[model samples]
Target: MEKKLNHLLADLVVEYHKLQSFHWYLKGYHFFDDHAKLEEYYDAIAEAVDTVAEDMLMLGFKPESTMKGFLSISSIEEAKNQEVTSVEAYEAVLADFKYLLDEVKGVKAAADESGDYLTSTKMDDYIEFFSKAIWMVGQEVR
Candidate 1:
């Protein structure tokens, strides 16, 4: 795998964990509903992370799954046990998704730069899906 792809994959793992933390820690009047939705989003991101790792393995590169590796590569904020309101949680998720949109786009760009059309296409699809999901979250916040 290209170095850029490795960086992006590591970021995906970190962001995946952050999303999961949000799902687990999320609270408010809409706790049940919002939690469920967050779980769905987090699960999808976890699957995408797996796909990215597999791609790295297929390219003869070792996948980075360690916390240290994620910390080193991710631009996304780490998950913390901060108390947040429903609106805050919604906004945080929206922000995270927006960040993910950029990261996935960067992954796609790296793939293209490395002449890996397949990876580029896959990342592009993920970017589109996450972007729409972020928009949905934004609507919910409004």
Candidate 2:
């Protein structure tokens, strides 16, 4: 459970940076909407990052806090370039959301198996958020 939580934390951190990169450098039509959406994404990811780290602490595990630590464990790759089109940004965001959803589901399952109801229930919010994000961003990408 701790390991899953740590991986989730790493993903959240990398995803946060990706959102920031998109929010800052995306261009062309839909820039306003995409920028605002990316801002919302990063904001939510920031909250998740903090929550996951605290959750780890509560479970008597140390959360990985450094960028190097996050990069090492996170499956999500960093933004390839600072600038990206709205389509490219949306595609990347959609993919990350899907990946994180799966990761969270796995974490929830592990927590349930371990009888850690607190951690299991905690993942519910993340599951819902990522599902909604995938739908919303899917529309944009499509």
Candidate 3:
């Protein structure tokens, strides 16, 4: 359970960077709007990273803080230097949100198995946020 949360935290860190990259590099019809949205997303991801890492600490686990650690554990890969359209960025984020939502469900199940209601609740909050993010990003792409 701790391991899963730590992996999710690493993914959150990577997701924050990816969102920042998109916020800075995305170009197209809605450049300003998409840029602002990605900024908001990256900020939210940063908060999630902090929250999850703290939760891992509470569970007596050290969170992965280095880029190498993150890259090794995270399922989402960073796309640095590649030119991406706003639609493509949104689609990528939506896919990431979908992936996170799926992982969180399994984490929640693990938490339940361990009788860790607090962790399950935390994952519940993240799951809800990711579901909404997926919907919003999916809309932008569509």
Q: Which candidate's lDDT is highest?
A: 2
Query: Which ranking of candidates, highest TM-score first?
Result: 2, 3, 1
True lDDT of residue 106, candidate 1: 80
Model 3 lDDT, full chain set? 0.87
* Candidate 1, 50-137: lDDT as tens digits: 8888888887878777888778877777778775666877787788788778877887887788898878988888888888998898
Candidate 1 wrong stretches, greater than 4 Å? none
What is the number of backbone collisions in each predicted candidate, taken in the order shown?
0, 0, 0
- Model 3 spans > 4 angstroms off: none
Candidate 3 residue pairs in backbone clash: none
Q: Report the Cα lDDT for residue 135, model 2.
A: 97
Query: 1 or 2, which is superior by lDDT?
Result: 2
The TM-score, computed over Cα atoms with residue i paired to residue i, of candidate 2 is 0.97
lDDT of the structure predicted as candidate 2? 0.92
lDDT of 3 by residue, 45-136 (tens): 89888888888888888888889999998999897877679988988898889999999899999999999888899999988999998888
Q: What is the Cα-based lDDT of residue 25 in candidate 2?
A: 90
Return the clash pairs for model 1, or none: none
Question: Candidate 1 versus the native: TM-score?
Answer: 0.89
Ranking of predictions according to lDDT: 2, 3, 1
**Whose lDDT is higher: candidate 1's or candidate 3's?**
3
Better of 1 and 3 by TM-score: 3
